[model samples]
Target: MFTLKIITANGNEVIHAAQDPIFHQASNTITFQGYDNLSNSVTLGEGLTSAGGDVAYLMGASGATLATWRYRQPVQCGSSLQPMDC
Candidate 1:
């Protein structure tokens, strides 16, 4: 199963949203599709830095294009979002 959570706040008020816990097994590395989108991307990394902020480490495989990650500045998780690039 896969679970994802997103929390948001307006002013001092806050709200919580989470998905069911989804599980996966990765012996060496893990790969999945549709993660380029925001909603499905929640299950990709260990933690969220800030919206769009990411740090990816790819192992040696074959093609250079096969081992790449997309990392922006602001990452989104819970209610806190920050600009990791700045």
Candidate 2:
């Protein structure tokens, strides 16, 4: 499973997926359930992707940047379930 961690000024949030999270490449929008420190669920308002699609700007209902999600490259270790040249 792949986990996305978003760092924010308030604290940190996370999203889990069986694969890499999906987002609109053209619109650069993303929708996901974000967990708070208390493990409470909240809907991510709207988000924007970076030009390189390497970063995501998570916004709040008020259109403020709540957190930032950075894309992490999958590990290429031989033992990993996903195949890759190592």
Candidate 3:
């Protein structure tokens, strides 16, 4: 099963919020979807990354990984929600 939990807090480290792990789908590289939304889908048989922030993970589900969306970040920063555009 997929589980995603986001944790947002203030700058003073007082408003702490618990978070959960997520995944990334890579074809050959273990990185985030910087400009590719298609590489961010939390589906089965996909690649993932968790190198920074220590807030995410990539794990197969039932050996098939087909569940709810656990983690997702916008590929396009100031543009449309496309799969290959940033």
Q: Pick the candidate with the highest lDDT.
A: 2
For each of the candidates, give the backbone clash count.
12, 0, 0
TM-score versus the correct structure, for each prediction: 0.18, 0.28, 0.18
Query: What does candidate 2's lDDT look like per residue over 1-86, in tens digits?
Result: 23444443333454333132355332333444334322222233233433222454545445565556443434457666332335
Q: Which stretches in model 1 have alpha-carbon errors above 4 Å?
A: 1-42, 45-52, 61-66, 71-86
Residue pairs with clashing backbones, model 2: none
TM-score ranking of the models: 2, 1, 3
Instruction: Please give, for residues 1-86, the per-residue lDDT of candidate 3 as tens digits.
Output: 23232221211111111123333422211333322233342232222444212222333434443333322343664656533335
Rank ordering of all candidates by lDDT, starting from the highest: 2, 1, 3
Measure candidate 3: CA RMSD: 13.8
Error of model 2, residue 27, in angstroms: 19
The residue-level lDDT of candidate 2 at 84 comes to 31
lDDT of all predictions: 0.29, 0.40, 0.29
The CA lDDT at 4 in model 3 is 30
Please name the candidate that would achieve the greatest TM-score relative to the true structure.
2
lDDT of candidate 2?
Answer: 0.40
